[model samples]
Target: MRKEKRSSKVKDALGSLTQDLIDAGLGSPFTEKELNYYGINIPEIKNISPKKIKVIREKAQFSQSVFARLLNVSTASIKQWEQGTRNPNGATKVLLDLLDRYPHILDYRINKSKRKNYI
Candidate 1:
């Protein structure tokens, strides 16, 4: 009756939400990017030029140190990456690709950190 219909609707909503969370956590094919943490045939990352690196940082509106902090990399590593002496690899490469494609996603984390500090 009505109870069964309501229960089914709730289940459907929960199922959709669960799928969205999984898609967000694992990535959707729509992004054309996947991070296989098991070290399988990972997708190739495009070569990042010095100018592109600078652009990415500027686009994120983060200073080198803050960017490094967000990336969990050392400031020296950011400097080297920007100077073309080194390149991001592994998870760093994946993360950079994600950020390059979805810059606004960082806003949540940055805002959350600021809130944490204020508290």
Candidate 2:
């Protein structure tokens, strides 16, 4: 959708070729700037409000402690985010965006009999 800077047909061709090369185990030769010119863009992370953060957590059915553990952050951080006292940034923001888009990403089944099988 961010192909406005270039011809869409050209961008699509280059993007597809780049992806195919990566999938075939040949590392990408294109730089990030080059990829962007080809219209292969990463989505920008949107700022999530306190209420939305609370909604996302509740929708995932995780307690603050569990969500914090999954995100490798402190329970206090979750509290702050939900209370509008702080904001998630960088990698945490990226992760939160992914969670917002894919609500079921955190779903996992516990196999009590096989510890290794638990996600």
Best by lDDT: 2
Evaluate model 2: give its lDDT.
0.82
Q: Report the number of the highest-TM-score candidate.
A: 2
Give lDDT tens digits, candidate 1, residues 1-119. Answer: 69999887876665565457665786334222222322123347877887788788888889999899888899999999999999988888778778888876676657564455543
Q: Residue by residue across 8-116, what tens digits does model 2's lDDT show?
A: 7777888989878876968687888987887666568887899988888888888999889888899999999999999988998887877887866866633346566
Off by over 4 Å in 2: 1-12, 16-29, 109-119
Cα distance off (Å), candidate 2, residue 58: 0.8
Off-target runs (Cα >4 Å) in candidate 1 are: 1-42, 111-119
List clash counts for every candidate, in order. 0, 0
Candidate 1 clash total? 0
Candidate models: Cα lDDT each? 0.74, 0.82
Pairs of residues at least 3 apart in sequence or in different chains that clash in candidate 2: none
